[model samples]
Target: MARNGRSERGATIIDVARRAGVSAMTVSRVINGRSSVRPETRAAVERAIEALAYTPNTAARSLVRSAELRIGIIYSNPSAAFMSEFLTGIYEEASSTGARLVLLKGEGGRPPAQAALKRFRKSALSGVILAPPLGETRSVLSAVRSWELPVAAIGAYDVDGVACVRIDDRSAAFEMTRHLLDLGHRKIGFVLGNPDQTASAERMAGFYAAIREVGGVEVKVAQGDFSYASGLVAGEQLLGGDERPTAIFASNDDMAAAIVSVAHRRHLDVPSELTVAGFDDTSAAVTLWPPLTTVHQPLRRLAAEALAAVTAAASAGSTVATCRAKILDHSIVKRESLAAPLGGADARSDPDA
Candidate 1:
């Protein structure tokens, strides 16, 4: 039966469940994706939805009246290059879903990008996606959890009330480190992300794991705040050693590029003399001096998933949950900057071995 618009009552939730051959609660949860539901069952529910001609009544006054929504995308980083790309992806995703994107770069006259974290409580948002320091900070997580608003973290942080949508930093870091090992690099150095960032901790775990797995290499690491300056500080440390790391893997491309600058200062040719690699595959990765071999983070997809979550959640008002945290995969891209430690970095390298 084709029901007309406006006054016509859409099919009830029970009808959808009946057609889908599942309980109404299952139908609700499948739509929500909050609790665990079988994939085939979820697909079947979706098909049943189409068959039942179901359309959510978001415009209904009662549905909209449950709770007012203010979605916030909060961050603590303000570096121009990395910050810009991250914000751009976030804005693109959030804006598309009709959620207002509050920059939350910090209020008051703060010195740098980090102070913004303190203001998340004051901001008017029902749901928030925290970036970096905000995503990982214990204080920030405490403040956010206290707010009782739904939050999706962009990295790996185990806050009780928060959900995470991020790559497995340990595995990604391990794989990247193994790549360098395959290139016959023994003295590999790592530049870590901000000490407070959980991803940094996980990434370090992976970096250490790679070194341990291969054995016979001196382990070394330097600290960075995931910024160009942080990279500079860490890069100098990487290069200053008497027995320098044959390859350096900075936590992110910004640091990697900074290390490239360090290499230039020492007149060491890239890849051939000293290889470098990074993560996040930001645009700056491509623009680097020989470019960088790095991990491809799916920022756009991540943002969209966050947006979809917030959008569905906000639209759900206070009627239980309508959406949840989603996971996505990252890839690795091999560019010019990473080659061999005087040898090649291909299958002949046998990273798994």
Candidate 2:
């Protein structure tokens, strides 16, 4: 039998709701045995489920409600905007799932990750989520493995025996660079993120790849640590030069916003005289004047997925046996911070027009 315009083999919650003539939430309530659902409605949902052969994703749904999960999150990220967004996502999921979260701030000069891990060792955490650049740190990953805890690393690439959730930083950077190139930017400045993180390298590689694809593009590179302070320094270095780039792409939003600040300080009109682009599409992107054009990295979703992965493994009393990398999608977000260079394409050809 047809299941609400879909094949009967893999019916979803929506299909069951359609068949029952009820909302998806009502169907969910019935499925989860919530007492608030009316008996008549519950009966309808069950009948629909049986008729459509709908099999709910019990693993995904039950893990949250079935048990209380104690999860530890270790972070020492420099970007406040990024950390804020990441924590918000984790809190949202934890609140819904009734999971208790232990936030450990990596502190002190002796490798902040190790400091946090030392604290974590004393806590009764069922699983741990390592936030970058901690996630990419070999020593930290090794320490977590030694603890025999189920682990999920956020924004780390190519590590063994851990679950990871991240966007394709390389592809996202490439797309952002292409966006600037398409906007008639031939001389572009790039602000690099923290050297410790793998994502920084990936983004740099992506920018260069795009530049190579379109020959004759002049590029300027500056160092940043994904922080406003680093951005300020980088911005000064890039904008201080005699020959300024028409467009600048910072590795993340915080730095991008800094670049904008530097431009303003230099009395350069944004978009008209300079176009600035950022990555991560963090809160900093929109909070600034002329909302930043950036690559939308799903920071919230990444955190949510990482939480889920670690929690699932913790609940199962096992570590993720092999590396399970869940790469999420990213998109290029266009905003007021970007525009065609002054004098347009003709400016590139004209020597003294």
Q: Indicate which candidate wins on TM-score.
A: 2
Model 1 Cα lDDT, one tens digit per residue, 241-338: 78887799989888999999999999999989898999888887988689999987876666655544544444544322222334578777899998
lDDT of 1: 0.71
Where in model 2 is the C-alpha error above 4 Å?
1-67, 108-116, 349-353
Candidate 2 residue pairs in clash (backbone atoms < 3 Å): none
Candidate 2 lDDT over residue span 161-216, tens digit each:
77777999999999899878876788999999989889999999999988887767
Clash pairs, candidate 1, are none
- Distance from true location, Cα of 258 in model 2, Å: 0.5
**Count of residue pairs whose backbone atoms collide, per candidate:** 0, 0
